[model samples]
Target chain A: MATDRIRDFIRTTRPDGPCLVVDLDVVRDNYRAFERALPDSRIFYAVKANPAPEVLKLLADMGSNFDTASVREIELAMEAGADATRISYGNTIKKERDIARAHALGVSLFAVDSHEEVEKIARAAPGARVFCRVLTSGEGAEWPLSRKFGCVPQMAVDVLVYAHQLGLTSYGVSFHVGSQMTNLDAWDAAIADSKYVFDKLARQGIVLEMVNMGGGFPTRYLKDVPSAEAYGQAIKGALIDHFGNQLPETIIEPGRGMVGNAGAIKAEVVLVSRKSDLGENRWVYLDIGKFGGLAETMDEAIRYPITTDRDADEMEPCIIAGPTCDSADVLYENTPYPLPISLTIGDEVLIGGTGAYTTTYASVAFNGFEPLRSYVI
Target chain B: MATDRIRDFIRTTRPDGPCLVVDLDVVRDNYRAFERALPDSRIFYAVKANPAPEVLKLLADMGSNFDTASVREIELAMEAGADATRISYGNTIKKERDIARAHALGVSLFAVDSHEEVEKIARAAPGARVFCRVLTSGEGAEWPLSRKFGCVPQMAVDVLVYAHQLGLTSYGVSFHVGSQMTNLDAWDAAIADSKYVFDKLARQGIVLEMVNMGGGFPTRYLKDVPSAEAYGQAIKGALIDHFGNQLPETIIEPGRGMVGNAGAIKAEVVLVSRKSDLGENRWVYLDIGKFGGLAETMDEAIRYPITTDRDADEMEPCIIAGPTCDSADVLYENTPYPLPISLTIGDEVLIGGTGAYTTTYASVAFNGFEPLRSYVI
Candidate 1:
């Protein structure tokens, strides 16, 4: 949903070209809700989701820690008034030089999923604290974090042992149920796997200190999702069942959930027409597309709710495409999107739940179109 | 293949981070080849493939016309020393305002596939020369452009008729065989479709003057494609068979064929590891991934030949991925790529056949990594 502030900003300013408008108030509320839901777990805002300076500054003011994937993100966090202790290098795949750069910038927490990554961190960051990420099934996640990321639980044990031997603190275990995960019980199996790793490490006299639960919290899109309180209760029940009252320090990295529903994209219909007189569906072209900012719509996975001024008119199915010449820029074709029959060229539409991944996924200048502009109010 | 100049530049400068190096000499040579192969057809270099200033300047200096997708691309071509007469607003889907802007910039040639688009040009550019694009089967292209662009052949005739009625010059018909088209006969059916439109419009007293044979020229990747001379001969044969001695003025757009082999990307191996002891293949993480510049690997469609220092060593299948935290960044996983067994972290590898569609497709900063840097020498 577009917050009142965002809607008013667009109605008044009327910025040229397609752009995303984010309401900081909505983000602030989302942050507070997460804090209330998971009071025991520290919130580390994932910088990759939406690293706009205003978003970073607001979250930093709220005392949120930062989960960064690169040295540039760590610098962005630090620049937003966060200290080095409040930043964690959370990407499991990193060059040794990047690891050293993060260490030099005072980042002490690092993530590792492989022996190679562990070796790099050990050589570059020395005695940094490392958390081993165990693989998850990602069954219920719309955007599954596939096997390309974490390792098997058994391999995580070996990775942690190697880190302990290399003088790096084997901090704990972590797992992601995947982005836009909907199943409340998705965290139960992962928490059990973390407990297994913890028990195996403890038997070797190497005690882990924390359990870093990677981000999976979902934001409302075309469908309603489980509330943050429901996710917190489900996760808490899993933690209690696995750890038996000896709970480890917990941390949650929320990327999309914190910012996804806080912004909206304003785009105009570029052209609308049928291929032939008997063509089945009309093709509606917009200024923005896969290369512009709506990349999460790849494969039509994340279908954002679209609202046009002519919503009261009779609706008709239409294929939505971007303004670029590339055929792959079609946003919705497998399942045609229904739009008002009265919709015409130059009509304005608002796409909701686009705050998180939209801006950063935009191409630099594909077809001479500029990257998605962001206006934080 | 990376030309000697590009390889030498990379070896000597050793630029930091993953970067693309384009050899202007190779681009010049490619332009010469296209001219020699299709002596009767004018060449319009598609700017969307590689809009680098040096590339545009080289083509412009060689008397090549430009097919631009947006107003900025038109400005870029003009800045590169091309006159407005040599530039065509080639994208069929455009905002009316963009059409007006391009017209204001003195661009008189436009492309339209639908009556709605034709109307936009008619209102914005008044009497601009317009071409109707007919749909093709896209049978033999590796990257098959689906029905997102172009219209049925019959509809193209209607569109051209409408453009002429609205005071726009119904100049001709156009169709793309699809990008990276490998089949030498792929243009035959499209050329036939254009001839049908010509005959249909001629009966209506709106004689089409040109057949804008759009870009589909292939670039060599892992497999060798038909040469420019072979494609030229096949296309010329199709034109002669269709029109006999009454062939219209012809224009061919070549984007990838002009620059795909002229550039190479220098990337570093970030990490290499297996998930478990029983895992079948190793995972090789590179500093660059789909979001970095290799977006054409969306479904592992374009497999560029990679060369490493240890290429002579024993080879094994590996799942290659980027350094981002996103799981979708994996380049080749369904069919793992075979790499040298001795390849290790920090090793330098060169990805060839990346001159086209690489830099422009890069995300601004997906995971805090900057957009793909380009160095044209």
Candidate 2:
């Protein structure tokens, strides 16, 4: 579906270099998949994944809730016609000014993991609805959401209790199993931790009535990532399995899975050559790289399955790189990716499943190269 | 030096969030330092290192030649008042349209490695001055130039010959020792390889007239990186050692080395907390992170020495991180960094020696956060 869309876009647009091609059709399908699997849950579509105006407008028109992280994202969501009440500020780290601004903009819901952050929110946005994050091991995540966020069960309980004391609305508990998570058990484990934090708060007579299942939903890439239905079913089962009939008003933050397959990048192969005479290793350079919208390729963490117009039975292993002069512009070096030996300069390279992070992560003209241009269909 | 400048800027400007403060006076001083050190060499200030307008204007006003990688850079250099002849299209992997557009804009110098790129140059901008890159081991460089660009010595010879055959001006051979190069031997070795390529070109009836000693000059950070004078002396010696009295017109593309020390970033600590009860390891979350602008800290490679308003004799080991929700936002995790235990949320943390790659590497509103605002004084 993406190939046909990309082909049609290329035939019409004919981009000279790298271009992001976003199809709203695939996005609508992905949203339906999530809805069908978790009919009981609310979708707080993570705005950070792909904050394209068209994508937001499509989701907002469907009355989807949004997971906003900053004041700007809150504004973007609002501008896209989503009600402020339908947006939740999910980032634990917030500036006081942003907190005040978001609250003034009517974003009453927030997420917190630290005592200092909770205090800031209380000072800046008093009476805002808040959620506590319990730490997850973040194992089996392509990009582990580890160490950067969340707290222990005791601390999570304390954060909620402190929120209640500060006259803030203690709403729920949240956790990110991590981005591109494959193992459903990781969510099972995180839910178990969230239950501990939730039960502890319930005992203290604080009935936090929301359960935020943070974003980590995977989209199809190089591997057979679990379908959105599979993830939604697993999460729903865990919520019931862990909490029984006491399941709180549920929210699922879907970023990557919601939009990853909906977009693709059409990049031109700038150069292709054999690096060493001794080894059979071939190096293929594209106009897009780490600083040029492919920052997700750091250490080959997020592999965007690549294909070219040129096909050959005799494929050669190659390392993919960006056009920047920096040595760190390499996209893939460790992975043994085989490309058609017939691939040559000026050939089109289509990187699939790049809709979510690719355009958003582009560097601001690292080498005088322009930011990635996206064409939404 | 940067602390005082930043404090003065913030006092006067009153920036609400992360600010990139670049002292043009310091940039001028750094430029003068390079000019004084490498008096015999032309300084093609690599624009990628810091594409700030003020930085470009200051360098251009001082009559410094620029090393531009793309058509946009060429326009920026020209807009900043640098003569077209002074700006070389140094990126080897360029689209033909960019080449044609840059040529129409009066740029003549271009760098090429592969045959296809050479052909594109020939077709788009015939008679453009060209340089071929010979592969370097990229040893003794912090970021290791590795296998991204450049070709073998044999390919270099063939490329130069091919450029000449295509009626393009085969000017010389170029090679990068890699970014932030510490070992002088890498340059010496690269110079030797350049000589091999140069000599091979000369024997083929083409007298190449330029040698570009590509950027890699180190800047002072956590450790005592060699001074600009030290690098200039070693490079001067190596150029002579390899080319002797017959040395061609030389160019040094000093990017980070020229502008790295001239800028500093004022970031606020969003949160600081211990990860778990068992481990005493603290994490200091800053408003800026890898996506926000400090992308050079790939795997703890480029370390920026940090200082805070709050200082104490009592310190704790900590991992620095950016405010983004991505787990990959962690900046430093490998090395032992001791931070003041008294440091808390809302404290201003100044990251020093960030002038070069900071602003240029920031993602374009990643997570709905604004680009790093730069104020050149």
Candidate 3:
């Protein structure tokens, strides 16, 4: 279906300039594959992944619950008609006002790590149901969730006990294996940790009804990356192994893995220059740079650069940079693509897999460039 | 006077939230110092460095010219009461519409890297003066300019001849030594290349009056980093060597070098935690991130962190990160400092020397965080 939608839905939103293209066909398949792999699991689409109202609306329509970390994200999900009972406000909440506001809006569940946060939440929202987030090992993973927020395995039990004393039921146990997790065992290990915590809490008269296995299933960018289906299978098997038939309502939040491959960043090649570094090696330069949004997400040195369909035959190693004066604004280095052709001034080049973070995260607002307009088909 | 004024006049301008504190007195002194070093040279405060109009107005009052790279910057400088005639639209002009706009705005001096750009300028702003940016070696510098824009010394001569035929006056030659240049020889090499280009252009009947040596003088965050005076002196001495007293309207643009040390980014420490990464280490997460600015300007890890005076006694090495969910949103790593003792739930921490690139160029309009509110005292 995704492949079919790609063929049929080449819809154009903006007449000219950068526009975010979302292929719902890809999204529908991504959701279905994730669902089939982990049947009977409650899926909470992390709203932070692609918070575009349209994207959220589609996910909500497909029976995907929302995992909101911030008050604003919860509001956006609510605006899309996501039922209050379906939202999980994971406990890494900072400001007290936000916690109270969430409670006032009838948000029931939360993620709690520290006692300070526990007391603050209890005082603000007394009847709020909560999850004690357990911090798992971040070995082999680039971004570990244990650093800033989350409770240690021992701390999770203590915090759960503390919440019970405060008349709040510990409804679930949540753990994030971290973002862009490529290692399948990382999820397995987190599940193992969650099981240990869940069993301990059960002996203390706390019945865990939910297991929030946070999403880090990386969407394949280049060749060699695992598909979303493979990631979903790994998580499903892990959940089944530990919890068996008595498995709690399962929830997984996949951010980039869900929407990364759905769109491309289209930019115009304003200037191209050739330079021989030492003896006879030449490099081409494009007009866009780090300010174009690729640099901030993928660290500027684009790991995977597939030549656009139009420019595939014109292959040459070119260094692309933003038009901004800053030098670190380089986009790609020594990219192999065809050139010496009429790919001159104002020619368009589409950088792939940029839909997720490129537009939403890093951009230059000072230059009067509006946010890349988004379109959903 | 600078220190006293900073203490008395500078305060966070936002009604309530994270903000930056800029000392106008130090900024003005830095401007005067750079101007004094290059006695005969005109100074253009590179608008791309820190474009806060309050900062611009301070520099404008202290008699600084502007090197604008975009239409927005040009408009900003004009709004700050900078004489439009004293501005030069530097290298990195990508769009043809941008060139046309620059010309229509009365920006006479423009840097042309390609024949296409030259034609665009000729058609758009026919009587424009031009500076053919020559790409020279600054091999070890953090961001080498030649890798992107500029003409080879040999190609530059041809470009000069082309501009001469097009009726656009090729007034001078400009070359950047690169940002954060530690080696004084970079300036030496660029000046030497300028001397060769100046002589070659003179023979072709072009009276080369100005030799613009672009910015990137280092600031005083690290101990051994050279002072602005040393950098200015080195450049001043080189210009005199190349053209003697005949140096035509010598111009220099010192962006980060002047402002980087004078202002600091103050963020509230929302949370602090310790995690074992090979060993146990404390992590300090802030309310701001790369999206807030200071994204990539830092070449290496910054160990120097200033907490609020109240927390001065409590110092520790903490990994500072932004509030964003993205993994790459790290501000500082393995940074050891005394954990400020008095710092509590809502105290601020000062990140020094973030004035230049942080707020000016790199910022993502995500999470609904607003443009940086600036305060100059």
Candidate 4:
């Protein structure tokens, strides 16, 4: 939903072209909610989610740590008032020079899922704290991250062992249940895997000190989603069920959940028509589409709730697409989107739950259209 | 293959990050080949494929008309020395204001697929030359365009009639066989459909003049594609078969065909490792991925041939991915790519057939990485 402030801003300013307006108050509230829900766990706001300087500064001022994927993100976080100690170089796949750059910037924590990555970290950032990411089934994720990222628990054990031998601190283990995960129980198995690594590493006299529970928290889109409290309580119960009394230092990286709902995209309907006279569905073209920022629409994985000024009118299913020359720019075609039948050209539409993973996914200038403009309030 | 010029540029400059190098000589040769292929047809270089200023300038200097998607593209073409009369606003979807802007900028040709779009063009750019896009099955395409673009032939006739009623010039019919199309006979049915539209319009005394055959030309990847001359011969035969002796003016919008083989991307291997001790495939992470550019890798639809310095070494299949934290960054996994067994971190890999659709698809700043840098030699 577009916050009252965001709605007023759009109504008054009427920024030209497709633009995203993020309400900082909502981001502040989300940060507070996450902090309260996981009081025992440190919050590492995933910097890649928004990376807006204002959002970062707000979170940093509120004492939030950051999980960055690259040296540039580290610089952004630092620029927003975060210390190196509060930042983690969280991508498992990294170049050796980047690792060295992060190390020089005083970022001591790093993520590694393979021996090769560990070798690079060992050489570039000797003695840095390293975490091995264990693989998850990603069964209940709306956006299931397949086998591209983490390794199996057995391999993670080997990787951590290798890190320990290289004089690096085998400080922890990490696993992402997957992005936009819905099932609350998704963390149970992953927590169990973390425990297994912890026990195995302890036996080898290389005790793991933390479990970085990577982000997968869901944000409300077209469907209702559980609150941060629900996720935190579920994750805490799982950690207790698996590790008993002594819980390792926990870190939760919340990207989508932190900012997805804080932003709303204001776009205009460019065209509305059926493919043929007898066509069943109306094809609605918006100024923004896949290349414009809503790339999560790929495979129709993330269904954004679209609201138009004519929503009070009778509704019909429509094939939604972007205003680009590419055929792949269609957003909701397989499962047509339910939009107001009265919607026509020049009508304004608000796409909700686009605060995260939007501006960055936008192309630089595909079809000569500029990148999705963003305004942080 | 990376052209001699591109290879020499990369070898001499040794750009620090992943970058695309395009050879103007290759582009010039491609333009000549297309002209030779269909002597009767006019070449409309699809600017969306590669809007590099140097590229546009080169095509403009060679008397190539431009197929533009937005007003910015029109301005780009004009800046490259293409007169407004030589550019076509080729995207069927458009904003009314944008149509007005294009008209004010002296653009007179427009594309429309539905009555609603025709109405906008008529109201915004009165008496503009409009072409109705007829639907194609998009079969025999490596990257199928699906039903997001055109209208059915019967509906196209209605659309053109409606355009004529609205005081717009119903100039012709257009269709895209699909991107990276390989089937030589793919243009036959589409051309036949155009003839049907032309005949229907002529019966009503609204004489259509041209047939805009939208781009779908293939580029050589791992497998060899038919030559431009071969495609030209096939298309010409299809046109003659459908139109008989009195053929209308024809426009060929060749995006990928004109530029895909003219450029190459130079990237470094960031990491190479197997997931587990018993893992069968090595995961090769490069400095660039889908978001950085090469978004055509979505669904592994377009596979660019990858070459390494150690190609003479033993070869094995590997799962290729980008260096981003996102799992969707994996380029090739379902069908593993065969690469040199000796390939490891720090090794340079050149991705060929990437001249088109690379720099433009790159994210503005996903994961804090810069967009794919382009160097036009």
Best DockQ among the predictions, by candidate number: 1
What does TM-score give for chain A of every model? 0.99, 0.97, 0.87, 0.99
Interface RMSD of each: 0.7, 1.6, 3.8, 0.8
Off by over 4 Å in 3: A1-14, A91-93, A132-155, A158-168, A276-288, A300-309, A312-314, A334-342, A364-370, B1-14, B136-146, B182-185, B222-226, B276-279, B297-305, B311-314
Better of 1 and 2 by DockQ: 1
Tens digits of per-residue lDDT for model 3 on A192-282?
A: 8888888898899888788888877766555356666677788778888988877778787766767777766556666655432233323
- Quality class of the docking in candidate 1, CAPRI style: high
**Order of models, best DockQ first:** 1, 4, 2, 3
2 against 3, candidate with superior DockQ: 2
The local distance difference test score of each candidate is 0.94, 0.85, 0.68, 0.94
Which of candidates 3 and 4 is the stronger one according to TM-score? 4
lDDT at position B151, candidate 4: 93
Tell how far residue B224 is off in model 3, in angstroms.
Answer: 6.6
lDDT of 1 by residue, A67-177 (tens): 999999999999999999999999999889889999999999999999888999889999999999999999999998889878899989999999999999999999999
Q: List the candidate 1 regions with Cα displacement exceeding 4 Å.
A: none
Q: What DockQ score does model 4 reach against the true complex?
A: 0.89
Pairs in steric clash, model 1: none
* TM-score, per-candidate, Cα-based: 0.99, 0.96, 0.89, 0.99
Output DockQ, candidate 1.
Answer: 0.92
> Candidate 4 residues B236-333, lDDT tens each?
89888999998989999999999999999999999898878885899999999999989999999988999998999999999999988898899999
Off by over 4 Å in 4: none
